[model samples]
Target: MSTTPVSEPMAIDSRSGSAAIIATEPAAQNSNHSCRDADLISKYDVSGPRYTSYPTALQFSETYTEATYRQQAQVNLKQGIAPVSLYVHVPFCQNICYYCACNKIVTADRSVARTYLDYLHKEISLQSELVGKYRPVTQLHLGGGTPTFFDGAELTELMHLLASHYNLSDSEQREYSIEIDPRTVTQDSLALLKGLGFNRLSLGVQDFDEQVQRAINRRQSVAMIKTLTETARLYQFKSVSYDLIYGLPLQTPASLAETLATVIDLSPDRIAFYNYAHLPQRFSSQRAIDRLDLPSAQQKIAMLALIAEQLTAAGYRHIGMDHFVKPQDELARAQQAGKLQRNFQGYSTSLAQDLVGLGVSSISSLHASYAQNERDLDAYYQRLDRGELPISKGVELTVDDQIRRQIIVQLICNLQLSIASIEKQFAIHFSEYFSQELLALQLIENDGLLSCEGDKVIIHERGRPMLRNICMCFDRYLPQGATASFSQTL
Candidate 1:
């Protein structure tokens, strides 16, 4: 009875308040990092941090109080403000997907959204004031139970609120995106998002199989998504991405092959292929899913292979872990230039170093720390009412944390890490500083997961799925078996 460790969709996985899980390379030259390497993968397929940050969300602490967050923000403000990114969390959802692990609200009361947005506006003003009202916003994301849950007017108002408070970028190069639940949006909604200055759309298309949709309680027709993708293209939305998950109830590799067939037919500009993390205890909605119908770990591996092979064959580039993009996509080009990055939003171009997360449970990575707002709605509103930033917990990066972060981000984003470069930048001998991490890498290196040359460690294409396991060696905070608390890295 081999079980796959559960992994949350990177969408809200950061809980730090980024939106959308980003991911790719060109069509002409296939990296062939495809499904053929599943055998090697099964051996290293274990649970570990996604490494969206070096010290992941698990390291956030109450000791780093709201005051600490404010202090950091003020420090950065005085040191010379940097351009920033924004992630707004919309916690409402009209329905529940049994396998979902995001922080979301289930309600038919549309009025609740109006109330949430009102509080969010207050948060925007407070955060902008602290983070710097005139800082250029080079990137923006709207993540949620479903960002589209807000009516067109409400969505418009939300954008206006952000624009009025912060320096919103109207440049053609700014990466503005929002997550869309097909069930919650229409062509008008897409039009509205573009008019609001969002150039990207992330569609939640978990799996189109009728049986899979019923089991997960998220049903949307292929016709619906096709229409939206077409409309997004027609409207010239810079990029349209789809979110697809594997290892759900009743999913077979063959079924996913069919799903990919349809997915390829529609051909989204980018796709986030995630594994379904089935932890019933943590996410109550998952308790609604019966464990028996879930795919075996091995089956899930095969499904991973199927996705890689098919998408690559269709001329999509396998860029980072779980993301495939067409050759011409900006993300692919960014990866080639070693500028792709991962945050709460998963994979993205490194548009800005500081990000401000607004709304309850949204996480902000700024002021040399990662700060999270109150997790629940009540505490969020309570803090805002008191005229305070709703930040509840966070971690400031130490020199070691920053060093380790650079190493991890380089490997995950650029597919290779320059040991010499790291040593030079940090002014430390790599071998002496990470002596134990290097010794531990013996097993990983022998397994052909990566290679250690004079001053470089290269992650082989086939070894990409095992990235979490490799990175765990450098994690100071990850105790043995602590991975049980995280989603698996299949």
Candidate 2:
């Protein structure tokens, strides 16, 4: 591991002392990326795609078919590509949470999941045949409506099927992660997961306060989280991450401050402080939430400020965007090494260039294109039953798309963009190719968010908080009209 301390440039905040600036170096390792410009945050906190993918999933279309994905797979196999990542989505949830935007099937019927599991295995087999059976998988993530919603035997069968068809890496160093709902999994169930080869666990604990939990209809207790975390540690899971959302209903500064204090005390390996995007029109479950109960934009910003202060004070490294980690965690390590990657699965330490997404609404990102399984479970099963890949939509990258992707990835993941590197990779004069963009970025530059030297564009401390705004300066496909489809960046 590289011991060279990282020097991240950051904006200073008066509220949090020096920990508000420059979240870099071992001494300041727990410092926040301290830009506290609420005015700027509010001004630039417009709806935008998270850019987990450069083009974003908004560009995926039905035009790019299963044949296109198959061709890409064949090309990958012929070239003897590196080990790929696998993302399996389990869309079954026993109940719905009001804040959820994920594609899910909510039901009381346990039998529904059994059928879904059978189809998931079939889809896995079909993908293996195209991508070549037993190709090494360096990273595997089981995400869901709730992955632990299935019984132990179902999960065991799922893993067995994966092992049988895919070259599942047994190396302890490889990442095998699963998302678990604390309300669903017990200590024995966690043990079952550890036995089945999952080493990383992400627990969904939106809030521990009973009021907030009740408002969101996810009534998990603080004790539930405490016990589950302790159990995960007992099993020696490599990493345990807790997920929290800031801008939800009933999230007052005092309430959230208490929540953060409790979370910090627990001291999970990683934390994701998400800004809840309340789009009732887009996600039906959200409609059930009373709009009047939702926090105002100003309150949301305050909640974010509290998050920055509390987490940084508790000695957590603000990795990027809404993610934080212990200074020694792989995510922090990856950030220091410039090897961190942003994908549909958020930040990943995996070096694999290709990711095969299995199950409903999952997305597979190839070298030159992106594919998504059908969002509707019935449609997804219908296609698989017909012995066809369930790729309902996708998009192939254009040359310009590829260039923009490289630039955006470097800037978002590392907080800096080397003009020469982009120029060399894309074979274009940086200034010449992005002349209009540079002209537009004068707005950001003038606002003290970033600085553009002769050969590099460096995100200034003030710009760190509005990283999305800085990244948006390079998005060529951003719609000029209304932006209701995306979430607020702050």
Candidate 3:
């Protein structure tokens, strides 16, 4: 599984964010990292973090408290870290999916949502006091148990409350997105979201096969998705993304291929084809699934191959990791321009310096530290009721961590890092500061994952999927035997 760098630069499509159809190199040249190669995938299909954040969320601890969050929030605000990003978590879901791992509450009670919304508004106000009510919010994301679980009026009220406290961006360039359970969202609901300035929608459609859907306890028809897609398009939403999962119970190569085919027909602007990490020991909902019914490692690899082949054939450019998008999409543009970023919300085009997370189990990444809110619903409520921030844990980054973070981000986003730039920025010799890490990377380099060309380390095309493995060598706190806790790297 090795490759030589192409003599010409790999094709990066110039058509907005369109597919980078590399004509100079044979498709098979990158097969070892492609979704179509089973043997290649099986060999490196090991567990690893997604690297959404440097040091990763698993490193968070109780030592970082609410007071710590407040102090950092104040500092970031007073120092003018403007045009920040906000992630609002809605942890309530009407039903549970057997394979879900998110922090969520399952209930059919409307009262629960009402109470939660009230507290969420309160938390927003409290945070505004610390960070100021008028800081420009460049991006606002609603992620959840099912953000659409709220009625139209409730959602409108929530939006109004946020606008009252935060000086949200008025420019069309701002990204206002929300995750929706298509089953619960209606045409009217879609209109409401559009009217409220939510320009992007991420729909959860793990699989369309009836048997597979039943096995995961999430049964939604292809017709439902078609209707939703049509409505979203009719409303002229800026971007519509569909989320699909592989490795669920009863999922086979054939079933997954069919799923991919249907997803391609839907023609979403973006697709997130994720590998389902079945960790029943960690997520209680997973206990409902039959492990014996899950796909074998080889089968999972085959499924991955099929997904890559199908989506690539459908004209979606691989934007790294599980995300693929039309080249003209903003994400593709950012990737092409080397300004793409990864955060708790996954890949984003926003370059905001600070990201504030509100609601239970939400995590905030500030300029100097990472802070997470209380994971327990009762505890979060109690703290907020007492007029206190609900922060539970976080870590403050040191100079070394910051340097490694910048390097990892560069590699992950652009697949290249300039040693001279890093050395000049950090005021240290690159070889001297990361001698040990460079030594470790030699193994991957020998495998053709990357090459150190004097002052730069360029990740070859075949190495794109293994970005996590490459970045892990730089993590200071990656403990032995901890890899098993994370999902398999595809």
Q: Residue-wise lDDT of candidate 1 within 66-172, one digit each (tens)?
A: 88988888787974557888988888889888887787888999999989998998899888888888888988888876788899999999989998999999888
Query: Model 3 lDDT vs. the true structure?
Result: 0.76
Q: How would you encode candidate 2's per-residue C-alpha lDDT over 147-206 as one tens digit per residue? A: 877899999999999998888999877888888888898899999999999998888888
Better of 1 and 2 by TM-score: 1
lDDT of each: 0.79, 0.76, 0.76
- With a 3 Å backbone cut-off (N, CA, C), the pairs that clash in candidate 3 are 17-327, 17-328, 18-327, 18-328, 35-305
Give me candidate 2's TM-score against the actual structure: 0.92
**Candidate 1 error regions (>4 Å):** 1-42, 79-81
Q: Count the backbone clashes (under 3 Å) in each candidate.
A: 8, 2, 5
- Of 2 and 3, the candidate ranking higher by TM-score: 2
Ranking by TM-score: 1, 2, 3
Q: Write down the TM-score of every candidate.
A: 0.93, 0.92, 0.91
